[model samples]
Target: MAADDVSVDDKVKRTRDLLSSFYSQDASQISPPSNTTSRFATLDTINTTSFDADQYMNLLVHKSNLEGLLQRHVEMAAEIKNLDTDLQIMKNNIVGMEVNMEQLLDKIMSVQSKSDGVNTLLFEKREHIEKLHRTRNLLRKVQDCKKASEEVMLVIVNKLEDKVSSDSESIQARAEAVMLLKQLDFPVEKLESKLLEKLEQFLEELDLSKDTSSDSANPHESINEGIESDSIPPRPEVPTREFVEAVHAYHVIFPDSEQHLVKLMHDLTTRHFEAAKQQIQEQVSSAKLSNRLRFIWTDVLSIDEVLPEAGLQDFAYEAARDVLKQYVTSLFSYLLHEISDALLQIQKDGIGEEYPLRAALEASKNALIQGSTKVLSDIRYLLDEDLGLVLKLRDMIISWVQEGFQTFFTQLNGQLLLLSGKDVPTDKVSSGLVLVISQLSVFIERDAISRITEEIGSSLLGGSYEYGSSAFYISMRTQRISVLLRKRLTTPNWIKHKEPREVHMFVDLFLQELGAVGSEVKQILPQGLTRRHSRTESNGSTSSSRSNQLRDNRSNTNRARSQLLETHLAKLFKQKMEIFTKIEHTQESVVMTIVKRCLKSLQEFVRLHTFNRSGFQQIQLDMQYLRITLKDNAEDEAAVEFLLDEVIVAAAERCVDPSPLEPAILDRLVQAKLAKTMDQEPVAS
Candidate 1:
C-alpha cells in the first residue's frame, strides 16, 4: 500500500541515489538497515550493525598475513556486487510482470466485447423462441446426444480404415481404434473381420508363392546325375520383402492365433523341403537327400533371424523342428513304401524267381545312408550356428534326431523285414529294408554320433553314448537275417531233401546274400576295428527270451531240445554257432554274422534229420568246401574251422551208418568243385 502511495517519478529518483552510493568508492557511502523504525529487529551471526571493514581486514592479516587480508577484501566486494545484482533482477522481474498484466487486460477486453455481442444475440433469440413451437424444440434437444455419439463413432472408423497397411504403425492404429470403439459401446466386428481377411490373404499368398516356385525346370535335379547345371533354377518367384512385411503386420493384429501363425510357418517350411526333394532326379537321388537338407538348415536358421520376434519369438524354430521331423518320417516311409511296392510289383509281374535279395538290400542301404546323413547335418547346423540366441531348441532337436531314427525301425512292416511267422517261400527275395535299417542304426552308433560329437566341438556326443535306438535296429536286423536264413536252411525242402549230389545249392545262394550285405555295410559305415569271436551253441530247454541271449552262449549234446531251443538248434544246424546279431557296421563283421548264423542253421538241420551215409557224405562235401571258403570270408578263420567241423560232427552224430569219406576221395570232390568256381570263361577282349 505504501509503495502504491508513491509516484513513479519519485521512485525513479530515489533508486538512482541508492545505486550511486554503492559505487561512490567511499567508506561512509554505505548505509546500515533501519527496519523501518520497528522494535522487532534483532542482531544475527554476521553482526552487520557492528561490522567494520578495517577491523575484519586487521583480523585476517593477523591470522594469514597479506594473502588473507586481500582474500577478505575480495569476499566483501563480492557480497556487495551480489546484493546489487539481486536488486537489478527484482526490478526487471517487476517490469516483466507489468507487461504480462497489460496483455491479460487486452485479452479480457476482447472477451468482454464477444460476450456483449453474444448476449445481444441471445436476447434476440429468446424473444424469437417465445414465438416458436414447443414440441419441435423438445425433439431437437432429445436427439442431440445420440447424434453426437454416432458421429464420433463414424470418425473413429474412418481413421482406422486409413491405417489398414502392412506395417507396425497400422497394427498400433488398429489396436487404438478397436479399444476406442469398445469404450464407446460400438460393435467392432466389421474391422476385426477385415483384419482376419488380411491375415488369411498373407498366408495364402505365402502358400501360393511356394507352390509357384516348384513349377519349373529346376537344375538341382541334374546335379546328382553328374551333369553341370546353373545355380539359378527356373522356378516360380518368392515374395521376399512383402513376405516379411506381412509377417510383421499380422502377428500383433492376431496375437491369439499363435497356432495359426505356427501352421503358416510349418506349411512354408514343409513346402520348401518338398520342393527341394522333388528337384532331385529319382534315379540318382538317394545320395543327395542329405545334401539338400543342409541348405534347408541354413535357410531355416536365416528365417529364424528374420522373422518378427514380438509374440511369435519361437514360432520359426518350432516350425523348423516340426517340419524336419515330418521330413524324416516321410523319408523312411517313402523308402519303405518304394521298396515294398517294387517287391510287390516284381512278384505280381513275375520278374525274378527269387527276391534279387542282393540288389534289393543294396538299394535300402544307399537310401538309409542319405537319410542318416541328413539328420546329422541338421543337428550340426542347430548346435553350431548361434545356438544360444536362436532359442534353446538345439538339444531338443538333436535328441529327436538321435532317438527318432531308432524308434522308427521298431515300427517297420514285419513282412517287409522278413519277420513273418509263416514260411517265406525260397523264390521270394526278402526285401533288404531290415538289413538297411540295421546298417543305418550302426551308422548312427559308430559314425553319426562320432561326427556329431566332432561337429559340436565338444567331448564325445556331450557324454558317453546312451544305448538309444541303435540297439533296437541291431536286434531287429539280426532277427530279420536270422529269419531269412532259417526260412531257407530249415525248410522241409532243405532239411528232408533226399539228395546225394553236388554241394547243396542253399550254400551258394546264402553266400551271395552275405556278399550283398557286406557290400552295403561298406558304403554306410566306418572301417571298424576287427573283433575276434569265439562262440558255441547249446541245445537245452529255454524260454523265448533265453533263445535271444543264446546267440551269445553254448549247447550240450545230451540235452533234449525244448520249444525255443529246438527251434534254435534247427535254425543253427544244432551246433554251437553265433546267431545273427548287432556286429560292427563293417564289411567283414556283417558278412561273418550272416555266415555264422547260416552255418548254425545247417548244423540244426543235420541234427534233426535222419540221414544215411549218402546224405552224410553230401553234407560232408559241403562242410569241407565251406571250411575252405569261410576261412577267407569269416572274421575269425579259427572260429569258422571249428564251426565247420562241428557241422560235420552233428551230421555224423545224426547219421544212420555214417561211413567216413576217405581223405583222397574228399580232396578230389572238394577240388573239382573249387576249380569249377575258380575257372573264368575267356573274355571277348
Candidate 2:
C-alpha cells in the first residue's frame, strides 16, 4: 500500500511538471532544476485514489493554479490541429500550382525563343539597311566626284569611312576617314601644317632629329648618348598610336602625303643611321652597335606599319645591310690594324723570335671568328627575332659580311706587303711568317669559313660558295716566299764551299717553322674530341707481319734499307716524310707551297753564285735531304720531285766540277742528318 501511494504520487507530480514546462514562456526558468522536495511536494499534497478525467483536470488546475495558462494551452492545441488541416489543404493546392507553373514556364520559354528570333531578324534587317545606306552613300559620293569639274576620288574616302566601323582595322581606318571628312571642309594648309608638326614630334620622339654631333661634342652628354638616354622618349617598337593617326590624317587629307611622309622618314632614317655610324666610327667594338641599330629599325619598321603603303620594309632591310656591312668592314679593318701593330712591334725587336708571327696570326684569326659570329648573331637578332624577317636580310646581310673578303683580301695582302717593305731584309726566323699567313688563309677558307657559314646557316649563301682570301693568298704564296727568301737565299747561302757533310741549318729552320704552323693551326680550328688509339697490336699475326716486312731491303750491304724498289729507276725513300700534319688546313698542302717556293728560290739563288765541287755536293746533300723531307709533304708528289730535280740540275749547272756524291757516303750523310735530328729532340725537351 505504501509503494502504491508513492507511485500514484509520482504520476501526479509528473503530470504537474509536464503542465508547467509546456505552458512556460521563460525557458530559462524551466532550465533551472527545482529542489527535489519542491518537485514531489505537489504529489505529496495530491489525493491518491482519484485518477478520473474530472479529477485529473481539477488536480492539474489546482497544481497549476492559473486558469489563463490552462485556457491558453487548450486554445493553442485546438489552433494547432486546425492549422495542420489547413496546411494539408494548402499543400494539395501548392502541388497543383507547381504542375500549372511548369506548363506556364514552358510557354514562357517558347515565347522567349520566338522573341530572340525576332530580335535576330530585326538586327539582320537593321544591318542590311545600314549596308544599303553605306553603299548608297558611297555611290552618291562617287557620282558627286564624277560630276565635279575638279573631281577627286571621294569613293575611297567614303569606303574608308564605311570601313572605320569594322572591328579589325577600325582604329587606322577611323583615323583616315575622320581626317578625310575634315579635309572636305577644313583648311588643307592647316591640316598639312598639323601633320608636319606631328611628324616633327614623332621624329623628336624617336630622337632621329637630335643634333647627334652636338651631343657627341659635349663630353657630359656623350656619356648619356645611347638608346638608354633619358633626354629622348623610350623608343616605341611601332609608331605611336597618335603618330599613326596623324600620318593617316595627312595621307587622307593630302594624297601626296605618303610620298611626303616616306621622304621624311627616309631622311630621319638616314640621319639616325648616320648618328649611329658616328658613334662607332672611332670604336666599333666599343659602341653599343646592336642596340642602336635595334632602336633605329624598330622605329622605321614600326612607322612603316602605316607611313608608306609599300617599299619601306625593304628599304629598312637594305639600309640595315649597308650599315652592318660598314661595321663588319670596320671590324676587319680593326683586326688588320691589330695584326699590323703586333707585326710592327715584332719587326723592331723580334729578330730571332719565330713565335710573334704565329701568335699574332692566331690571335687575329680567333678575333675574326668571334667578331664575325657576333656580327651574324646581331644580324639574326635584328632580322629573325626583332623584325620577323629572316631570309631576305639573311641572304643580303650575311652575304655582305661573309663575302667582304672578295674586295678586301687584296687590300689585306697589299697591307701585309707594305708592312714588310721589299727593300727590307728580315731574319730567317721571321722569314717563315709568309707561310704562317698562308696557313691562316687556308684555315679561314677550308675550316673556319665553312664551319661558320654552316653554323650561321646556308639558307642565305645560295648554292655556290667562294673563299677569295684562300685562293688569293694561295695564288700569291710563291710571290710572298720571294719576299721572305731575301733573308734566306742570300749571297752567303749560295757562296758556301763546305763539303757535303750534313743538312744545312735552313732545313732545321724550315722544318721547325712548318711544325709551329701546324701547332698554331691546331689551336685555332675546331677540335671536337680526340681518342688515342691502343698502341698494342691486335694480334701476334700483325707483329709477325711487321717482322716479316722488315727483312726485305734493297741495299745488299749490312747497312739495311727500308724497301727494295720494283724498278731501279724509282727512288726508294723513307715511308714517313709528313711533318706538321694536323687537320686538312695544316697537312701536306700547306707545307708543299712553301717548299716549292723555297726550292724555286734556291734554283734562282744558285744561278746568282758559282759553286766549286764541294759546295756543289753540299748543295746536292741539302737538296737530297730536302727532297726526302718535302716529297711526301706535297699534294703533287711528282711536281715536288720535278722541282727538287730542277734545283739539283741548277746546282750542277752552277758547279765548276759537278760530280755525283758516292751512294754510301750520301746515304751515310742522310742517315747522320736524320740521327742528329732525332738526338736533338730529347735535348730540346
Candidate 3:
C-alpha cells in the first residue's frame, strides 16, 4: 500500500508536471500580443511542451486534445526548421547569382566601350584613306603632266638630232667643195665680185637713156662699124679651115688613142684645135724605148715555137698609156705575184738545188722597170691623181723589191749549198749578197713602222722583228754562204750597218750537227713510246709470233697517239698563246680581279682534298682534342671552339704567309697522283 501510495503521489506529480508542460510558457516574452493568433507560435515556445497522458482524466481529455495539437505543432515545427535551412541555402545562392550579374554587367559595359573606341578608330582611318586617295589623284595628274613634258622634250631632241645630222652633212659637203675649189685654183670670191660689177655696169648703161634724134648720126656711124666688124672680124686668132682639119684628124685618131692623146690634145688646145695636134704628135715620137726588153721578149719567143713570151712589152706599154698609173701599178703587183708563184712552183716541182731561173727572172725585171717608168711619168701629168698613184707605186715597188730578191737569194743560196757539197763558204763573202739581206731588213723595218702607225698613230721606235737569235737563224738560212761576209765587213771601221756583222762559222756546224742529231733522235725514240708497255711474255714459238703482232700493234698505237697528242697539244698551245697575248693586252686591274677570282675558286677546289670519312673524321677528332685542352669548364663552347681556332689559323696560314712554289717538286709528287686524271683531261695536253 505504502509503495502504491508513494507511486500514486509520484504519478500525480508527474501528471500535473505533464499538464503544465502541455500548456508550456514562453521565455523572453510575457504573452502573445492580443492581435497575434494562437494557431502559430515561435520555436522556443514549442520546445518546452513534451509528456501528456490524458491531462489527468477529464481535464486529461482537454489536455489530450491540447497534447495532440501540441504534437502536430511539434512536427510542424521540425518541418519549418527544415524549410528554414532550405531557405538559407536558397538565399546564399541568390546572393552569389547577384554578384555574378554585377560582374556580367561590368563585362558588357567594358565590351561596349571597346566597340565604341574601335568605331572611332575606323572612322579616323577612313578619313585618312580618303585623304590619301585625294593625294594619289593629284600625283597622277602631276605625273601625267611630267610624262607629257618628257615626250615633248624627246620629240624636240629627235628634231635637233636630225637638224644636227643635216647640218653636219652640209658642213662636210661645203668643206669638200672648198677643198676642190682650192685644188683647181678657182678664186670663187673674186669671180663673184667681178660678175656683180659687170651686172651693175650693164644695169647702169640700161638706166641711162638719150634722145634718138640728137644721137642719130652717132648711132648710124656705130651701126656701120658693127656691120663692118661682123663682115670681116680681123682674121680670128686661129683660122676656121685649120680648126676644121684638126678636128677631122682628131676624130680619125680617136679610136686608137685613149685619155693619153685626149689629155695631151686638151692641154695644148685650150680651145685651139690645130695647136693641140701639132704638140701631141711631137711628144709621142720623143718617148724612149727599152733595149733589154726587146732582147728578151723578141729573143725568148723566137727560140721556142710551143712556149711564147711575146707582146709583153707592147701590151705593158699600151696598158700603161691606156690606164696610166693604175696599169703600171697592176703590172708591178703582177710581177711580184708571178715571182711568189714561181717560188712555190720550185718547191712543189722539187727542183732541189744547183739550178735557178735567173735569166727568165732578169728579163721579167727589165720589162717591169720599163712599164713602171712609163706609168709613173704619165701619172705625173694627172696631178690630182698623181699623189695616190705615187703611194701605190711605192708600196708595190717596195713589195716587189723585197719579195723578188728574197726569192732569188733564197734559191741561189740553196743552189750554191748543193754545188759546194754543203760546205758553206767561211771566207770573205760577197757584199752584193749582204746588201740583199740589209734591204730585206730595211723593208721589214719600214713595213713594221707603217703598220704600227696605221694601228696606233705615229710613235718613236715602233714594233720590230727583234734582231736576236731568231734573226741570226733566218739570215743564216736565207744566205747560207753569205753569212760569212759579215766578218770581213766587220773588221773594216768604215762599216756603219753592223746589224748583220757577226759571221758565226759555228752556226753552220751547229745546224748540221743539230739536223743529224734530230734525225737520230727521231729514228730512235720516235713518239709515244712511254704509252706502250707490258709485263708478261709467252714461250719462244708463241713469243716470236706474238712479238711481231705486238710490235705491229705498238707501231700503229704509237702513230695514233703521236698524232692525237700532236694535234691536241698544238691546239692547246695555240689557245694558251692567244690567252697569254690577250692577258698581256688587258688592263692591270682586270688581270688582278681575274686572278683573285681564280685563286678563290682554286681554294674551293683544294678544300675538296679533305675527305668526309677518314680525313674529316680525323680532323674532327683532333679538333675535339684541341677544344678539351682549351677550356675544361666549357659546355657548348667545346663544340665550336676548335672550329673557330682551326678556321682562323688556316685563313692566316694560307693568305697571310708567303711561300715559295717548287714547280718541279710539286709536279713529280703532287701532279703524279693526278696523272690518271690529267692523262684523260684536255688541259695543256
**lDDT string, candidate 1, 454-521, tens digits:** 44232214422432233343445556655664664456443344645466666666566666666766
Question: Once model 2 is optimally superposed onto the true structure by TM-score, how far is the C-alpha of residue 665 displaced, in angstroms?
Answer: 76
Q: Pick the candidate with the highest lDDT.
A: 2
Q: Where in model 3 is the C-alpha error above 4 Å?
A: 1-119, 157-392, 395-685
lDDT of 3: 0.34
Best TM-score goes to which candidate?
Answer: 2
Each prediction's Cα lDDT score? 0.52, 0.56, 0.34
Candidate no. 3 TM-score? 0.15
How high is each candidate's TM-score? 0.28, 0.32, 0.15
Which parts of model 2 have CA positions greater than 4 angstroms off? Answer: 1-191, 194-206, 209-242, 252-258, 279-301, 308-310, 347-386, 406-408, 423-685
Better of 1 and 3 by TM-score: 1
Between candidates 1 and 2, which one is better according to lDDT?
2
User: lDDT-based ranking, best first?
Assistant: 2, 1, 3
In model 2, the worst 10-residue window by lDDT is 532-541
Candidate 1: 10-residue stretch with minimal lDDT? 37-46
Q: lDDT, candidate 2, residue 3?
A: 69
